[model samples]
Target: MAPKVLFVLTSHNKLGNLDKPTGWYLPELAHPYHVLHGKTDITVASPKGGEAPLDPASVDAAKDAVSVAFLANHEAVWKTTRKLADFKGKAADFDALFYVGGHGPMFDLVDSATSQQLIREFWEAGKVVSAVCHAPAVFYDARLSDGSLLVEGKEVTAFTNAEEEQAGLTDVVPFLPEDALNKASGGKFVKGEELWAEKVVVSGRLITGQNPASATAVGEAIAKALGV
Candidate 1:
């Protein structure tokens, strides 16, 4: 049997109060799903067992090839929109766990006891624990058995401060991931290119992507690291 990968997605939207448009920035979910969905047996789950809310902007008209392909993915369409409880995990059943991101995660995921426990439990088993974009925010409160911060001194990346600022939603976000990661990690943070840049960082079994654009690359790293 193919190695099982547990993919935890967010069911909430951070932009709930905003009258503005938003959706699951499809690339953040679709790109990685496209790359890993077929080769790996993937399980999709969310904080609640319900259809995940999409960032409207992700599905709006886009003239790019990536966006077009992302919108057309059947596997992503069929399996990705699931509730967290529907795919509740047992770490040993999966070889790796990937958390897809969006501004939504900054709110729902961080506040989820289920996701936090899942993160800690998966890492305790030495399984690959990965997240991209805002999803990494979920790790701010996680820790190791030694009491050290979970990501301390590890190479990592996330949605850039500039991107958050550029989006004009930083002030409204639950917490700034770039800042929370830097402060909580107690490790100096670095960038790959620039805001909205395609950046990915890997240290052992932990993997992160800079922004939604880096999803597929980060997925590739997770695949390679887990030897899938």
Candidate 2:
């Protein structure tokens, strides 16, 4: 049987204090899904149980073949995502947990108690807990069984402070991803040589990607870790 992977997406559609819309980034979710589609059993989920919103800017930014194919062929998976809370205490059912990123997660998933609980469960179960780009925001408040921050001393990367500024959302986001991860990891957060460079860091069972360009590699990392 293929490994079971749970893909968590943000439900918040509105960007922080702005009229603009945001949700999961298209390529961050689509590229990984495209890579793992046949090799694993994926369960799409969100904080809310219904349709997961897509970041409109990402849709426009990522018009690649993989992203376009995902939007066209996998509507059903994301359109009706499972409620994240429903998976509580059920972490043993899956082999990995993946968080999809966008500006929206910085608002909702970052401080979500349910999300924090799920991350703890997955970590304690010896399963992979991974996220890409801004999705690592979910790790901001997650703690392990020992009550230590999940990313503490763990090598991790996320949408960098520079990239956030490049996107012109430095002041708009609830918190900067790179700064938050660095603090969470006790300054262990690292980045690629340049902005938008593809970088995937695997610290034990935790996998993180630096930006949208790293999404596909993050998925491949998950597949390799799972031996799928």
Candidate 3:
């Protein structure tokens, strides 16, 4: 049987307190989804059971070919996701847990008790736990069975502060992913020399991607970890 991966998307739609909208970033989800599309079985899920919002900016016409293809082929999955709360105590059913990022996860998943619980369960089961871009925000407060931060002392990478600044959302988002990850990892979080460069960090069963540019690589790493 193909390895089953649970892809977690953000249900939060509003960006900060602004009138603008945001949710899971398309490239972060699309790139990774495309990478594992035929190689594994994937389940789309979110904090809410129904539709999860998509970051409008990521849907621009200038998006890469893979992103376009993903929307055309797999957007239905994105439109309807399983409620994350239902997956509690079900870690063994999955080979990995992946968090897809946008500004949304910084708000919802970061504070979600259910999300934290799932992460701990997956880690304790020795299954792959991964995220890309701002999705790493979920790890900001995630602790393992021993009561230690999941990212603590683990080499990890996520959307950088510099990249957040570059995107002009430095102060808009609730918290910066880089800073949160740095604190969670005890300064073990690393990034590329330059912003937006593809970087995927794998430490044991934990894998993280620096930004949307590294999303596909994160998925590839998960596949390798699953021996698929």
Candidate 4:
């Protein structure tokens, strides 16, 4: 049987206290969905369920073919996402858990007890746990069976401080993803040559991608880890 993958998205839609709209990054979800949908059973979920918000600026279908296709089919998937709090499936039922990111995750997933528990359960069960860009914020409080931080001593990468600066939201976001990951993991963070460069790190079954550019590679890494 093919591995089942759960795609967790953020329900938070505001950009900090600015009231600017923001949600999951389109390419971050689109690229990975395109790559893994066929190889694995992909299920979408969010903390609040229903229609997870999309970052307005990141919704350009003209940017890539994957984005175009995803938008065309958005209604079917977006309208039916399951709520993470109400998901009936167990961690063992899925082979992997993927967190899609935008500025939103930094607010909700970072402190979500449900998300933290799920990540811990998935990791402890020997299932793959992966995230991209701001999605890594989910690891902020996740712990292992031994109670050690999940990303502790693990090679990981996410949206960097420089990249946040480039996006000009360094101060707008609650906290910098790279900084949070480094502090939470005792400095096991890594990055690429420049801002937005594609960087995917696979530390055992824990996979991470640096930015939108790294989304597809992150999916490929997850597929490779599952031997699919």
Q: Best candidate, lDDT-wise?
A: 2
Q: Candidate 3: where are CA atoms >4 Å away?
A: none
After superposition, the stretches of candidate 4 with alpha carbons farther than 4 Å from their true spots are: none
- Pairs in clash, predicted candidate 4: none
Question: Poorest 10 consecutive residues of model 3 by lDDT?
Answer: 54-63
Residue-by-residue lDDT tens digits, candidate 1, 192-225: 7667778888878888888877888988988788
Ranking, TM-score, top scorer first: 2, 3, 4, 1
Give the least accurate 10-residue stretch of model 1, judged by summed lDDT.
73-82
Query: Which digits, one per residue and each the tens of the lDDT, describe model 2 over residues 1-228?
Result: 999999999899998888999999999999999889999999999999799999989989998999999899989888999999999999999999999988888988999999999999999999999999999878977998898999998899999999989899999998888888899899999899999999999998999999999999999999999998
lDDT of 4 by residue, 81-192 (tens): 8999764338988999999988989988898888888998888888999999999888877887788999888888999999899888998988888888998878889999
> Candidate 4: lDDT of 123?
86
Clashes per candidate, residues 3 or more apart or on different chains: 11, 0, 0, 0
Clashes of 3: 0
Question: For every model shown, what is its TM-score relative to the native structure?
Answer: 0.89, 0.98, 0.97, 0.96
RMSD (Cα, Å) for all candidates, in order, is 2.3, 0.7, 1.0, 1.4
- Give the runs in model 1 whose Cα sits over 4 Å from its true position: 14-16, 21-23, 61-63, 75-89
Candidate 1, lDDT over the whole model: 0.76
Q: Please give the lDDT score for candidate 3.
A: 0.90
| lDDT of model 4 at position 15 | 91
